[model samples]
Structure formats: C-alpha cells, structure tokens
Target chain A: MVEYKDGADFLSPDPIETQVLQGSQDSEGVELMVKKNNDRLTGWVSYTLSRSMVLINGLYEEQKVNGGVPYPSNFDRPHSFNLVANYRISRRLSFSSNIVYSTGRPVTLPVAAYYAEGRPFLLYSARNAYRIPDYFRIDLSVNLEGNLKFKKVAHSFWMLNVYNLTGRSNAYSVFYEVEDGAINGYQLSVFARPIITLSWNFKFGNYNSN
Target chain B: MNIQHTYKYTVTKLFPGGVRPKMHLWVVLIIALAVNSCIEPYFADIGDEPELISIEGSIIKGLSRQEIVISRTTSLGNPVFEPVKGCLVSVMDELNNEFVFDETYNGIYTLEIDQSSLVEGRNYKMVVVTPGGAHYESEYEILESSVPVDSVYYDIEPSLDPVNGIEADGLQFYVDLLAPDTVSRYFRWKITETYEYTSAGPIHYYYMDLSFEPVVPDDIWGLYRCWKTDELEDIFLTSTLNLATNEKKQIPLNYVSTLNDRLKIRYSLLVHQYALDEEAYNYFMQNKIATEGSGGLYTRQPQQPITNIYNVDDASERVLGYFWTSEMTSRRIFVSKLPELDVKDYFYPLEIFNMEDHGAGPFPMAIMEEDGVRITGSPICFDCTRRGGTTERPDFWE
Candidate 1:
C-alpha cells in the first residue's frame, strides 16, 4: 500500500513513506574501486550487510500481523561490496574503472492452495524459496578534453564500458505460472551496454561562482 | 617556500648520413595532467531501520465503530504496516469512557456499538499502543450525513414508422450528496424496476442507465418479469460507500430492459456513519483498482427508454421512487422524449455485412434511428464482420 500527504499524488514523496533508492540488500558482500591521482593511483575494497521488506496492508488486511507482517519483500540483500582503480594514460587522457559483486535477491515461491469458488488459491508457501546466481561486473571509462578554435568552446570524448569483463549479471530470479503443473523458474539478468559520447560545450555563464 | 623544479634529458644518436628527430607527444600529455589531477575515496554502507507508522480507519456512526487501519512507508509498492496481532486499541469518548476494539484482521481493529452509543454531537478519538510500546493517536468527530436525492427522468421515443408500433422508453435516476466536512462514510441503496411489455415471446432486450459498466441480466428471460412477480428482497444493488463526500456527489440509476416497453422505478437508501481525511482519500485513489473507483463513484442521469419520440405515444408510465427520507427527501419527474432523429433523409452509399464472422443476420436493422450513425451520418452494419453474430443497435436503449 502507498501513502501520500495530499492524496495519491504520485509526483511527490511523503516523508513518512520510505522508499528503496538503489541497489539490493546484501550481507558482507565485497566491492572493488580504483582511481588515479595525477601520476599516482588509489583504490578501495569494501563490504555491506542489510535487508528490507514491503507490504500492502491497505488491500490485504489478513496478512497484517502484530501491526504488519515481515514478508519476503523486506529481505533484498544482507551484505555487498565494491572495488575500483584508475590509471593515467597521457596528459590528455586517463582510465578509471570499478568492479562490483553481490549476492542475488530473495523471491517468494507459491506452494499450497486455498479453495475459492472451486478453484485453488495459490498460497505463498515459503518466505524465500529461491535465489538467482551471484552478480559481478566491471565498468571502464576514458575521459579526454581540449580547447578548440571557437572561443570558450571545449571538445570532449568519452568511452564508457558498463560491463567491461563480465558479459551479464542476474539481479533476481522469476518463475512462470504452470499451465499443466510443471514447475519452472526464469532467470533475470543485469543490463550491460558500451556507450561512446562526443560533446562540445560553450560556456557563456561563469564556470565558477559564489 | 616549497619549490618544484622541472628537468629534461635528451640523448642524440648519429645515423650514417643525417640525424633523425623523434617526438614523444603521448608521454608529455599523460605526465602533464598527472601533475594537477587527484582522486578522492569515500564509501559508507548503512542498514535498514524501522520506519515510522500512521493509523487510519472507520467506525459506524450509530455505535461509533469502524475498522481502524495502520500503515507504514516502505520502498515497495506494497509497503508493510504492522499487523494487528496483539495490539491494544480503544475509543475514548468525551466522558472518558474507553471502549476496546478487537483485532479482526492483520492491521484492522473493529468496534461494535449501537445507535445510542454514537451520538452525533459527541466527540471521539482512537488511541493505539503497539506490542513494542510505540504509541499512536488520531481524533474524530461524530459527523452525520443526510441521504441525498436528486431529480429523476426518463427517455421515451417512437421507433421510425417500421418496427414496433409502441414507443420505447428508458428510466434514469440521479442523486448528489455532499459531506462538506469529515473523512469517510459507507453508502448503500436498494432499487426496484416495474415494466409491462406488449408481447409474450422470450424477453430479448434489457437496458439500464448503468454507470460506465452495464450490468447484464443473468437469466435473459428475467428481463420481462415485473418486480411484483419476484420477491422484493431480490431486487436491489448493495455496495460499500467508504468514500469522501466530494466523491459521493452523484449516483446514477442504470436500467435493464428486455423489449420496447414502459417502466416504473423506485429505490431506497441506507447511509452508514464515518468520516474521511486527505490521507484516507489519497490511499483510496492511488490504490483504487478500477476506473469506477476513481472519479465521482456515483452515477445519476436522465434515462430515455423509448428509442424514438415523434413516432411514440404520450403515456403516464407512473414511476414512483424515493431516496432516504430518514435523512433527506427524493423526487422524480418523467419526461416524454430526449433528442430525436430522422433516419430517412440521411445520405449513405450502402451498408456492408459479414454473415459468417459476426453471426449477424442483415443490414436492415442497422438503419434503425437508435443505432449510432457513422461520421457520414449513415449506419454501418452493426456486425461489420458478423462472425460472432453480434448486432449493433444504437436505436436499442443501451
């Protein structure tokens, strides 16, 4: 169930309404980061541990307990981590990249059934029935900038590889409805794309100001 | 002063005849930028914390009790609020009398009371304590609503000189109630239809002034029977009215008809007590599943029964109906006709029909004045493909 301060205004967020900003929950997961300072290099190795859940008490009051139920939606990931690095190629160019790996999200699997109008209502039998494969990916980007003939105009070209090493990563697992009683699960994968952008900018306003 | 110095060393090699010059531009670009650029490292991860919670719900006015709802903010569309497991809740009146409510469902608590307990002038408030010792409170006023009733009218018109010699008619009932103040309330109504047909054949047609969604007859033949033939107990529509007053302003009476005939209509209303706030209104709207739940949840309009008017007769079709006289009075007036049409003079090339796909018989019925006309003001065969045998009858009162 969703709450709004004025009425279901989807545009605004209610302070009382908490939301998932980004990334899934995981416990003690590792991440790799690398950066270049001038001719020097810097990097980091980190870890995370957490979980979250969501419920629709407004619609199905039966599932609410205590004040509400701790359904499977709350446990995204208990822990996670990242790794990064950077390298200087020349005065006009530099290379930077990061690698991330985390455990998959939890999915509810329906098992038992309750009778409704002679049809069995599929009940979510277990809290977290299945998990997708682990997630790991690398991203690399190069930055280049120079002054052109046009006054105040600077040209820049960037090449970004969202997934540098690993081709694809799966975030969550999904299962299709059985037409004749065959249990099957569908795997979801992380999006990977290589982006090339070339841009030129003219600065009329002050580049730096109070 | 910390002074930085720059230095360069060059090595020259002589060839057989002339010296060759080599420039290392790549090395110069990278070394130049490395002298000024720097990177910062910062990363921190935090876990989830229990979010805040808020409560809302309704209590029937008579005993001043309704289901109470407590919800919380979560990232998922289906956010979880605490379940009603073992929480304790009470309604406090002005005299400090506390009435305990039961946790009927997960986050719902219900209180049962009689008419005398929920006096209109009394003030009330609900207080709840969570099992973990968190406290929540909300206040409410015992607001009363008057059953509202609007004008009622009918649609009667004559079919162009061909089909049935009698006029076709339809009925429309309308009502608009206002609750300028308060949060929520429940509404219910019971309507009855009385009509007489000219033929004894199976009831082939039925029409009602339904909102957007038309409620068709379960037993097609039942369309011809009168409210008197069947038990009165079986002739009503029941629904919950937990919407805001601004939302319940208009309610329309949809009709069900079998054939071209005259009809008499009557209905009664029952209003439950409760109030709604902006929070409750938003929750209902955002989470509202159907189009019917969105805009004004009620529908009321002028109903034209007879397909035509100029070729029809003037009949008293005395249709008697009343709204909740307990709270407000309702009145209705029957009209002879709505807008009429002259189909003979309209221009058209010819109508096409597909007998197999639509299961329809002929195009002649498409010319009926009630059937909708194309942009060219000409009628298209109701079943263009006709595979399913469906016929378009704009002339038939929908």
Candidate 2:
C-alpha cells in the first residue's frame, strides 16, 4: 500500500527553533527471508535493501537546508541482515542466538573551511553525504527448565542471556563541533560494551492448560 | 486435575515479597537504555572548491572615472583577498566604440569616458582578458532613462539594537522618486554620507623646550573641526511595477542610531538613483535575498549568485559578479540635531587638564572650562587630520 506522510522534523545545528525544517520522505525496500522451523536447528535468516530520502524546500533563503537538494534520510540504511536460531540441547535445556548487521546511517559533516571577517567558518558537505560505520552485533541466551513432564502442577525455568557478545563499538551518530576556533569530528556509540543478565520465570497449569 | 487449583497454588508461592520492586528496576534499566544516544565529531574531505574570476562595475551617465574591480576567489581557509592584476579591461558599445581602462590600483581599473558617449538607450558590455589568457565578457546591458529624485529626507523613528535589546531613537533616511508618466522602472540607490565630528578635546598648548611649561600657539588652525565620508555597503532596491502610479514615495535607504556620533553636529547624505533593467533587477534581488537572508528553519536555500558574465571559451567555467549600465540622478540633504532633545545625557564632555595645577607658573594654555577648572585637551581634538578627512569643505556642501 502507498502512504503519504508530512511534517517530519529536520533538525539543524545552526539554531534550534528556527532551524527546524519540514520535509517528507519516501522509502522503498525489498525484504527476503528463509526459515527452517521443524529441524533440530530451527532458525530464520532475513535481509532487506532499502533507500530513503527527503526534500525540504525551506520557506526562507536562510532556512533552506542543503541547498534545497534531496538528502538521504537520517534513518536510511540500504542493507540489513538478521539471523535468529534456536537449538534444543536436551528436554530441559535449550540455546538461542541472534546476529544482526546493517549499513550505517547518513550524517552531515564539515568538509572545508574558509575565513570571513577574521573568523574561521566551516563549509559543510551536502546533508547526509557521509555515513557512520556499519553496525553488527550478536546475542546469545540459554534457557533451563526445572521439569518437562507432560503433566505437572507447577513449572519453573531460568534464563541466562548475553547481549552484544562480541562487544562491538558501533557508532550511533557522528557530529562536528567547533572548539578553539577549529572544527572537529567525533563518534558516539550507544551500547559499546557487552551486557549479561539472569532471570527466572515460573508457570502453573494443569495438563489441559499446557 | 483442576487447572484453577494448580494456578492458585503456584501464584501464592511465586511472589514471596512482591513484583513491584523488580518491576521498578526493570523500568529503570529500560529508561537508561533509551537515553543512551550519543554524538561524536565527524570529518570528511570534500576536495577543493574551484576559484573563479570576479568582476564588479557599473556605468552611469554623466559620471567620470568609471572603474571596475577584478579579483579571484581564494581557496576556502584563506582570508586574504587576491586581486587579479595586469589584465586588459575595456567597455564597448553596440556602435563598436570602446573606452579603454587603465589599472590605476591593484585589481582596480579606471577610465574617463566622455559624457556624450553614454547615451540614454545605448547598449554596452565589458570585456576582460586575464593574464592567464582567459577571455571573459558580459552580456550587453541597455542603459535605461532614470527619474530624478524628488527629495531626500529623514524621519525620527524608534529602532531596536540587534545586539542589545534596547529601544533607541534613530534616523531613517528615505528617497522619493518623481512619478513617471506610464512606464514602470526599477530603481537602485547608492548613498554617500558625510558627517562632522571633533576629537575628545583640543590641545591648544604644548610643553616647550622640555621646561614643563606650556606655550600657547600663535594661531589656531583646522585641528578642531573634522569631516568623514562613508559609502553605504548594503544593497538598496525598489520598483514601481506594481504600484498604482509610476512613483515610489519615501523608500528607506538607511538608518543611523541617535547614539551614533554622526548625528552629533551635522550630517549630510547624497543618494544616487539608478534606473535598472529587469534582468539586472532580478540579479540584484537574488543577491539581496542570498546575502541578507538569515539561515535557520525558515531560511531560503543558499545558492551561488548567477552572473551575466561568462568565459568566452569555456561556458561551464564559473565567473563571479555582475556588469550593467544605467542612467542615474542624485539628491543631497543635510540633517542637524533637533533642538529640545536632551543632548547632555548622550554627549560626554572631553577631558581637559590644567597646567596651573602642575605648578607651571603663568603658562598660557588654551582654556575651555567648566566649574572654573582650566582645561587643556588632547592632540586628537586639536588635529582634524587624525580623523581621516579634510578640513576643506566639500564643493557641493550647502
């Protein structure tokens, strides 16, 4: 189905309130997936390719963002891959894992510099001309059940999970800042380290409720 | 086996304390994860921007020493302006008559054209042959007949200082164009403002022969009164196309705050009005929108100003600036400080020292005293040359 949306906020660093640009985005993509659900190794692999762009013709001459040219949307990522798997080790023990990879998102960056009125001013590249590093992460978890009988009055289980198992530092965004009369670029990562968690679950039901 | 009985037994044992505390912790963790967004510095190399030739000039009827400025755009990061020197520049009309320009200053070429040569409706264009053998030319521009300015006047208005949010008294200068019969014309204005000011204090006596004693000069010269002239920088344009009549009334040309020293004594403004063609008007209108417009949410996209001049060999090569010819008229007006205005509060008296207080007995010092203290002013007050203008009155001054 085709849909129409408007009033998307395009934020710029020049000024907060007045620099907010209005634009619409159009995104199109194709997704493919394969699954094996009935085997010992039950998993699904999915991949998607997409492109999204925005055109913001500013109301005033100064408000025009990126010279009124169409720019890649901030959330645009052309490629994404996901792999999820579950393996049954025993009647009481099972393991699950997930792997995800995606192309980096677009970002605006400064590419040149010039001096005006005795001050250094940066000339920026086209909006969203550069992208952050590609993103990749893996997660694994183990589940253990106290009992697996057909009929039981109550059941208990435990889960041990590890997120970002490889501890990859994927940049969430890239920004340019002026310090000491010079412009510098920096990368920021949201989840830069691995995380582990342990949890317990309990269930109570008769044979008919199973 | 009853399902209700089994669920009721497990529920009673599952929560020994309560689920509230655990749920609170989970909520905190989720919030922490949600706010973990970050930003960092990014650098990208976009290569160098091409340098282009810049030409700026205009031909006006009844004006002498017509000049053109030639310069080259420097690389990004360079603040110094690079002038295009040693170039052959000339202006030609449709009749094949030419006015050759001589490089009077670096990147500035001047030509003295006979007033008779500049006809009201003649078409003219400028040509420049650079040192690097690149040929450039401007499209032929027709000289449009100009309407004389009816008058130039000023009005007192309240204006806000952009830097400080203070409402202050200001002078708004305006120009009125004589009404035409039926033809609508585009108008461009250039202003030259001259004002008189004095230094903080005038020095009448000087320490003579290192004796610590002061000597009064034999005669007081042009040291106290100074005059300064400045050309307005901003673009000013108006059109009578949409007006009911072919007349534009009281269009604002510039503004000067009452706090400005230019209003201390006397100020004179000379406004030159030029008749512009439609294309020239559009070019300047676009330029006005680009340079004067502020950037933000409501800003118009910035684009390189389109120019009429182009490279003869390579059409795609970029050239900067504009060339046009027009007939012009001007009017001058003088403004004096209005009486009954509280001038004492805004004008600070210049500091003067007394030689008698230094125990120099019976020394002659120029004295202008308040509260019975003999005052001697600084050299800047006594020397008009330090103010960057001449003491000779302008020939056109009334």
Candidate 3:
C-alpha cells in the first residue's frame, strides 16, 4: 500500500470517451368511448392511455439525442380524457358543455448555466428530459331556438358561447431568454384566457343551420 | 324540439327573411387582439442535474502574467460561480521548462513568465491537482504566433437591430488582418471599451434639517467627468479556413447604438486578437451558437460542449472549458466628435416595478431637470457611473 502525508500524485489524462446510440421507437396506446343518445340529449365521453419511446445510436452516432436510451417522444401524452354533454330545459332551450384533460407534452430545457467571460450561458438537458405542465380546460354554450314554423319565411336561433370556461393557461410551448447575465424561462400560450361570443343564426329554404 | 343547423331542402321555405345584426367596430378590434399569443415565466423541473467542473485558461505569449480560472457550474435559475480553490497548478512545455502558478485569488492562478520565455512551435500542457487530490490535465496544445492587427477602425451606419427591429444610426467597429497566406485561418478577438461621461445633471434643490420648503444650494452634486471601461462580453469569431487567402478586410467586431453612452464624448477601444487551433476554434464556434440564444422557433437543440481538460482517471468525468496556447496581439484607438453620426444615451428605469425590474426601490433619488422639472432615479442614473461603471477616469483616456 502507498501512502502520502498530503495527497497521492496521478498522471496522464484519459482518452476522450464516446457513446454509441442505436435503436428504434416503440409506442402503445388504448382508447375508450361511451356515448349517450336520446330525444333530450346526445353526447359522448372518451379516454385514452398511451406511451411513446425511442432509442437510436446511429444518427451517424452523433449522440445528439437521448444518449441512445429509450425516451418519450416530443408529442407524447400518456393520459387524456374528453367529455361533452347537452341538457334540454325546454323544447327550444338547450345548454352544452365540454371538459378535457391531458398529460403535458415532452420538452427539453436548460438545466444549468455555463459561465464564460463573467457571463452565464445556458446548458441544456437531454432531449425530452421533462414535460410541460398538464393541460385542462372547460367550455360551455347555450342555444335558444325561435318559434318552429315551416310556413314562416325562415327559422332563427340565438347562441351564446363561452370558450375556456375556467380560463386555463395551457402551454403551447416553452422558451428561454438571457438578460443582464441571468437566464429566465417562459411559456407561451396561444389562448391564455376565456372568450365569449354571441351570434344570431338564420336558416333559409336552401340552407338552415345554427 | 331543438333546432338543428341544416342545409335548405331542395324546395322548402326557411327563415324567409334572413336575420342581419349590426356588429360593433370595437368588438372586431378586441377579437383581433385576442388572437395574439401570450407568454408567462416558467420554471422547469429537470430531475437531478450534475454539478460540473469548469476550467478555463490560456497562455498568452506576449503578456507577463498568464492566468487560469477554475469554477463550478450551477443551476440556470441560480447560477452562482462557485470557485474551486487551493489547487496545485503547473505548466510544462516541450523543452522541459516547468513553471508553477501561484494562487492569486480563490480560484484564479497566475504565473509571471517573461514574454521571451514563451517559445513558438513548442507544445504546452497544463496539469491541476485539486485540494482533494483529484488529478486533471489538458492535452498538449501547440503554441503558434498570432498575426498582428493592421488597424482598428469604426464606421457609422444604420443597423437593423434584430431584437427591437429598429434601424438606428450607430457606430460599427472592425479589425483588419494582414497575415500572409501561409498562416492559420482560425482566430478569435475580444474588445475592451472605455468611455467618458457626465452625470445626467444635478438636483437644484435638497431638503434641509428644518425647512418648510426645499432649499437651493450654491454648489450641487455633479460628477462632471468620470470614465468607465467595460470588456465587451460578446464572442467575436472569424474563420477563413475555406478561403484560399489568409488576409481579410473589414472583419466586423462590435456595434453600439448611438442611443447609449459608449460614444457620448470620447471613446476608446482596446482590441486583442488571438490565433487558435482547429479544436479550440470549433469549440468556440459551437459555444457561440449556444450563447447567442436565439430561443426562436428555429433554435437548434444544444449539446454539452466537449472540454479540452479531462480527468486523469476517468474519461466520463464532467469537465467544462478549453485550455489552449495562443500568441496574442492588441491595438487601441480613441475616437471623439465624429460628424457623420449622432449619439444618444439609452434610457433606463431606476425604480423596480414588476418583471425583469431590479430597481433602486419603491423610492429613488429625485433630481431636478435643467428646466427645474423633477425626475426620480438612483444615484447611478444621475452619475457618470450610472447603470454600471467606474467613477475614476482611466489614465489612458485623453
């Protein structure tokens, strides 16, 4: 055994190591749907479960992706559910609502900062190393029909639609920025708030729809 | 019966008279604005990130002291440079001349070697032993003399600012290389800028120990003239490996919008040029891509950079940075009162509100404008060193 009062001396730097990645993608999924149809209402509820994974060693063996291991794809969402229902308070009055939920999409982001010249640069994580926040939203609409008269020149209905009832800020994508030597992250949302729209519809002899 | 939206029958009477409703112009404007996208700050959850070792060093042939820096990388949100201290560092050249570097600061090691001691065409390598006895070494890097900079010059032109999409008149600087066709084509340049500025102005009034109203003073606080020198932090890379000739003209370096104080009165640029090898050049080229940080739709995925330094025992050790040898050259130029362009000081806030706002606080020092109008801001905003700078005038300043 060798011992030193302070520390042992080591020599020679090891050679540069390279990783090899070679594989294929695999995915599996299942979906179920339940429907309710009747004179008063018609709607459906659906749920889905899925997984997507990939492995590849030879993009010219660049190791540019997930280090050759199986990782979820960019669009992977393991679980999702959607529900739609309509209720009729009267022959001419009906209200419809929709609910949806889904696991977030896979994403790659900066894990740390690389500093040079007294400034910080971004260091990214492995591809698809994380996921965005989960997504959930709800919407509703009310339909009011005018008097039913085939002899009348035309029929009309008034509709009030409220999109994104809960005003959920679902992420469309994630991005980053570097300012004053500090790095910050932000998420972009296509529809960040609820939208309400009111419209009047009329059906002529050639076309009647609301 | 719920009314169903349907197409008209071949010959049936629907809403005999179609319904027409008036739409408000404001509602259309609101809808048009709503379709635009929105953004919010986000913090990602990246499982467990590895804390890495970062070693950056360079052997400058003409400089008296060569410095090497060692530090650790931290999370992006909280990137605090953790210096690695108490290390044994030394360099050995091909001729067996070994020089030990002293710890000038926590993680910075420096060695005072005469300019003549650096011999061109000789291979130099570095070895570092951490306090804990972990050994690390950089591959043998060959030193090559650098090509001299013929001149450093500036041109006044309007730039299409990529960030703000504004075309404003600004000063664009460039450097010329007169290297013969036989030398290496890979090179890097770093520019340091020094400028003189006066405070925005002084407050004509101040509150006294016991005064019902503000009192005007015979002498006000005015940083009449102070100088600030800053090393422009962007990487300027030039490669002509593909071109048949080594000589190039008008290699663009730095650009400053006249809207800032860099060229307000008298400004100087100290340009340092370095000759690099293929590996070092490639490393910097890739790092340039990573640091530019377009963060747009076309942003290419980033990969961990390959460091020239490595662990002696394990090749898999996570090490960062490049250690290389270069014969460097530098040139300095001063400019003042150019007639072709106009200069304007960029404006900023001295108060912290929301977002990326780091301000003096809810209340800032208020100064009276030249016309007696009042403006509130931090001391920096009113002094030559406002924003970030040194108050002492540089001896090199004319």
Per-prediction fnat: 0.01, 0.23, 0.50
Q: Taking the tens digit of each residue's C-alpha lDDT, what string does model 2 give over A1-210?
A: 111112112333454445355666889999999999886789999999999987766665444555567778878999999999999988678999999999988765545443221223333445678787899999999998886576787787899988888877788766555455455567788876677778997778632344
Tens digits of lDDT, candidate 3, B1-398: 22332333211233244322223335555796566577999988766777777888888897788998888888776787778999999998888788899999978999998877798888998888899888899999999789888889988888887777878888889998878766678999989988877776665554332322456656556543677788877788888887778877899989878766678788889999988888888777766766664543234555657578999998778788889899989999999967666787646444322223323233333445554445545566556555466766677777
Per-residue lDDT of model 1, residues B1-398, tens digit only = 22221111231232223333234434444345333222222111113422434344444453344566544323221222334356787777778878788888876678776656665546676666778775555544443443443334333333332345544333434444454444234333333333222112222222222221223345434322222211122111222354433445335444422133233222222222223333333223322221222232111110111100010121222111100101212333332222342122112233332234222422122221224421111222222222221222222122
Greater-lDDT candidate between 1 and 3: 3
How far residue B307's Cα lies from its native spot in candidate 1, in Å, is 50
Once fitted onto the true fold, the runs of candidate 2 whose alpha carbons sit more than 4 angstroms away are A1-210, B1-43, B179-184, B207-211, B215-221, B294-298, B340-390
User: Which candidate tops TM-score?
Assistant: 2
Model 3 chain A poorest ten-residue lDDT run: A1-10
Q: CAPRI band of model 2?
A: incorrect
**TM of chain B vs. native, candidate 2:** 0.80
**lDDT of each residue in B24-116, candidate 2, tens digit only:** 557767667644555544445445654667788778895877988887655433434567899999999999999889999988889988899
Using all chains and alpha carbons, the TM-scores for the candidates as numbered come to 0.31, 0.69, 0.62
Q: How accurate locally, in lDDT, is each candidate?
A: 0.37, 0.71, 0.74
TM-score of chain B of each: 0.34, 0.80, 0.76
Ranking of models by TM-score = 2, 3, 1
Identify the runs in model 1 with alpha carbons over 4 angstroms from their true place: A1-210, B1-54, B63-65, B69-82, B104-107, B140-174, B178-398
